[model samples]
Target chain A: MEEIKKHVLDCSNLNCPMPIVRIAKTIRTIEVNEQIEVTATDPAFKADVEAWIRKTGHLLISYAEEGRSRIAIIEKTK
Target chain B: MEDQKLKEYIDALVEEKVNEKTLAFQNQLENIQQQLSTVQVRENEKITMLVTSFELDKVIPAFIIANGAASFGMDVTLFFTLWGINALKEKSIYKGKNIKEKMITMMLPSNPKSTTISRLNMMGVGTSMMKMMMKENNIETLPDLIDLSIDMGAKLIACQMTMGMMGITTDEIRKDVDFGGVALYIEEASESNITLTF
Candidate 1:
């Protein structure tokens, strides 16, 4: 299997727009098809990430939760 | 009988031509409508907010929305006028030349940190309690939110007329803020898809 390049973004304890905003900004810096694994503790992070991905037309590889932290792996398609 | 048949044939031809023309016109209209809807979507990507109040509750929501929109890749403009201008002021000890200006400076909060809530302030106790709660919840402070909004590319425009009336000098305001008047606000608000007053 080919190894995929991925980046990590830690948004622990951040709420609302912070996680989404940082994701949007970070997506621009990486090359297309690269993945970003974002971990945030905000309760709304999962829903916000889904909405953001829908609006921005990105691909959500996977989303999971660990304790209080919500994690999402998003691929930058554009 | 031949003449009658000829007349009927001509009428049928005319009706068919008219129907074809009408269908073409309708298609053209649909294309134009699609183009117009696309333009509307593009224009709606911008948001303009008019902040006229300096109360902590009001200020927090304004910045939150502004920052949120900015983070969402929307163009956000925050126009500060009257008491709202105080949110952009630097927290410093400066004296005004005239007594009225001095009094105004003394009465108004210097910056977002010192601003009081609209109701249940109880001599700053409520504001303090709210700030403590926000801190405990990992929520960003008002000052931090303002800075983040600016950092996120939200345009901050201070009302020049209000500054003149309140005797707020340019030096007292943050250097990153742009100064404007009512005309500027009108221009931004007209182009924005969302216009809110706080």
Candidate 2:
């Protein structure tokens, strides 16, 4: 198996549409083979981020709840 | 002596570099002009204009758009109707003379707020707070905004259907408003590139 390089992203203070927008932008700037781990605190982050991930045809490896914050690991397919 | 001569030579080279940059900028300007000449913009450019029937947060954008479009030389019309009609009501609402208006303002905290905040715990509290804040800030309430819209030729039209549904009559509506049906609105909006429902 090939080793996957990953980057961590923290978007705790962002509101609706902003977290998704920032993540999409970050994904575009990364190399095709790398993955990004996103962390956010907004209550709507899970559904919002997941919806965006599905819409953009990206992969959501896993999502977890950390206290008030929610975290998701996503991979760039392109 | 030789060092002094070298410094003079460097100064001359810097002056020549500056001249070269100026020429390059001039050349870039000419290139831009050439590109502009070849670039064709459509004769009939579509412009988007918003039509708002809601109050305050919604109406503010309409006013801003109308002012912006008029300033930009675009044909802009904002049609105020229904509750928006109250905005055009006599400025006396803000003057505290109308007991009915005062009662409605006092009772607004109990009514359902805008659709966006109805599900929240604060319910109409946010809207109530907004109204109070506007009064304190000397911001025009919904009625005053309607008056402003009228003064700007924003085309305040009371919806015949809405008024009929609400059992409101022409006598009840403010004097500045022109009553119209959906067909008239559609006719006016036909030439518009932008139409928004608030």
Candidate 3:
């Protein structure tokens, strides 16, 4: 599905937990059902985000890799 | 008439059994909810640190750990005693050109910035090299971590008895620090889930 993104959180050059920390803070302002894209360089970004999404009941629209960077889109479900 | 009494008695008994089963099921659901609530509380657990190491390597790591936990919304408390209080001091009590005090200041790190590693410090050269390495790796410097800890709400506590024993005046240390004693540290640690001594 082609999901239109409104917010982008660029966490490039950030280390583990920083990206996740920023996402936790940023996701609060987002409206439910609207998609947000998180781009990160941390090798553990995929695993961290996936776990957080699962716990928070958010919708993971899709995930893809770009070069050495990891990108994931999530929609706030609650 | 006897048959009617028997039927009524059976109906009453069945109703009581159904009520008891419903109550038991409701209690089970409550217990599951309580278990989930505890998991969420663990994320916001309290962390307490008793930092006594004045060694540059040890002190820097202490700040990093405390601040890192604080970033995740944990309640962090740092109890500074003896040499640990030196990290919180902005200026040494041994200042103003008193020969003996000056010599003591020279012997010690005096402040967080001038701290040297406990081991492998080759006449201060190793410390400078370590700082350079941290920069190259994008790790926050000791001072940066300390500032972040303060800004992000980590409580910094100084031991009152240690200050008196070492002749350190309140004015020498940062004003933001709260003065406490061993008993105070114990009180805070009693309720803390994570207690670390560095």
Evaluate candidate 2 by giving its C-alpha RMSD to the native, one decimal: 17.2
Descending-DockQ candidate ranking: 1, 3, 2
lDDT value for model 1: 0.89
Off by over 4 Å in 3: A1-7, A16-37, A44-64, A72-78, B1-43, B95-103
Which residue ranges in model 1 land beyond 4 Å of their true spot? B1-44, B92-96
**By summed lDDT, which 10 consecutive residues of candidate 2 chain B come out lowest?**
B109-118
Better of 1 and 2 by TM-score: 1
User: B1-198, model 2: which lDDT tens digit per residue?
Assistant: 999999999999999999999999999999998888765532222233334344456566555555433322345555555555444343222242256555544333211123122233276677677767656644444444445444434566767766554444565556866787767677767867666665
Off by over 4 Å in 2: A1-78, B1-55, B80-125, B135-139
- Alpha carbon lDDT of residue B69, candidate 1? 84
Residue B77 in model 2: shift from native, Å?
2.8
Q: Between prediction 1 and prediction 3, which has the larger lDDT?
A: 1
TM-score of each: 0.82, 0.39, 0.68
Could you tell which candidate, 2 or 3, scores higher by DockQ?
3
Q: State the iRMSD of every prediction, in order shown.
A: 1.3, 13.1, 3.6
Residue B56 error, candidate 3, Å = 3.2
Clashing pairs in 3: none
DockQ of 3: 0.20
Residues B1-198, candidate 1, lDDT per residue (tens digit)? Answer: 999999999999999999999999999999999999987877438899999999988989999889878866789999999999999999644564588888888999988889899998999899899878888988888899899898889999999999889788998899899999989999999888899999
